[model samples]
Target: MRDDVRRLLASYEPARQQPDPPLPPAGVLLLLHDRPGGPHVIFQKRTDRVRDHKGQISFPGGVMDPGDPDVRYTALRETHEEIGVRPDDVDVLGELDQMVTVSNFLVTPFVGWLDRYPYEWRFSSEEVAYLLEVPLSHLRDPRNLVPDRRIINGREYVFQAYRFGDDLIWGATARMLGNFLDLLSALE
Candidate 1:
């Protein structure tokens, strides 16, 4: 099962070439676990002080550092730093499709499984504003799932959504989640 999950997430990152304009590096985690109901994932709200995506609900990840070994290492390390979960605690299954954000960042999403829930979490007041351990069932709810259309640089774009409470998980985060659901649906 763990190996399977890893494979699914890994499918998201394709080895592609960006000729003239190279993409900025970023990464995130798509964590999952089968509980009494079904699978679940985690989310966090960025602090208003953060330079980008402030006060918006997001995954616990960030831009890759030069010191990181690879993109996978970047995702694992960022999640641990933001959520206070050590890298060993998360068994990375695979990765999700890479996404291009409006901010021009090319983010790599990784999937992980955690059986033992961590007791406590600490956040950087400068980066994380709120935390949510959202269940996969809740995200799968059609009511919360909505469509979002936009015109970026005169090009029309459509994205999916997962609204949790007052926060709207749309844009890159939501698109990534939507991709996850699409993959899970295929397995069913």
Candidate 2:
């Protein structure tokens, strides 16, 4: 999978598109690691007490701090802070296309590879509710994907989400996963 990912990313030129400026910059990591059965991606269920996006299933990251030299720094630092993944433990592959949230955040998603399996998680009680692993094969299954529609401010918006167990992976995280899977499918 690692070799395939590298080859696909190399052959494909990511737009690296940026949304309009002045939006608060944030970074999230699409962290994939080996598990017992197969590869899986890690996600955090945010504590309901957080400031924003409370109780949402999200990647382990937050807004970029001024001390962060770049978005990659933001992603690695936040991942380490939120969970227990050490910065040195993560092998960052590359970044996907940037996305803008309805709340006006320019979110940069970074894909990182962790060769090690079964990480010891130390969740920050203040931020993380719990951590869950969604198998890559489950995500790849089209039967698990669903589209939701809603009307907001007289505009109709649709969101694609993936369901695994009782958890609903939606919003930006879902979009990012879709983009990654789309690229992976191109390899076929």
Candidate 3:
């Protein structure tokens, strides 16, 4: 499966979009680790102290800094800052298509692989509330895809999301996850 992921990513051409006026660039790491049952993906529950996406479940990442060389670097840097995984520690598989967030940021999702489990994780309490290590099998189950409805300014919005216990993965993150899962499904 790991080899399949690497090969698939190597040949994949991610779709790109250039919106008018341009949105600020952000990067996120879809960190995957090999676990007992199967593979597990890492997600961080954001603290309410953060400015954007507060109390939301997301991959470890943030906006690109001026000094960062590239979007990939931004993802790695943010991952290291949010969690303790160093850039060198991750075997970066590749990237998925760019996603535009409701917060007006162009986010690039980079997939990375870790060799083992029970990794020494040091997370930022100021930004991260907790970490969730979700198994791929659970995520792949169609039953987990739950419909979410919200009302904003007298308008009803329906969204497709994944439900893991008390957490709801939706919006751009869910879209990105859906894309990643589609690729994995293609391999099977």
**Which prediction has the highest TM-score against the true structure?**
3
Better of 2 and 3 by lDDT: 3
Better of 1 and 2 by TM-score: 2
Q: Write the per-residue lDDT of candidate 1 for residues 21-131, one digit (tens) a residue.
A: 877788898776565666678888898788898788888888889898888888888888887777888887776778778778889888788757543677776788768
Estimate every model's Cα lDDT from 0 to 1.
0.78, 0.88, 0.93
Residue-by-residue lDDT tens digits, candidate 2, 1-188? 88778777667666555654678899999999887778899999999999888898999988999999999999999999999899999988888888887768888998898868777888799999999898999999999998868688999998899998888889889999899999989877
TM-score of 2: 0.94
Arrange candidates, best TM-score first: 3, 2, 1
Q: Pick the candidate with the highest lDDT.
A: 3
Residue by residue across 50-132, what tens digits does model 3's lDDT show?
Answer: 99999999999989999999999999999999988989889999999998888999999999998667799999999999999
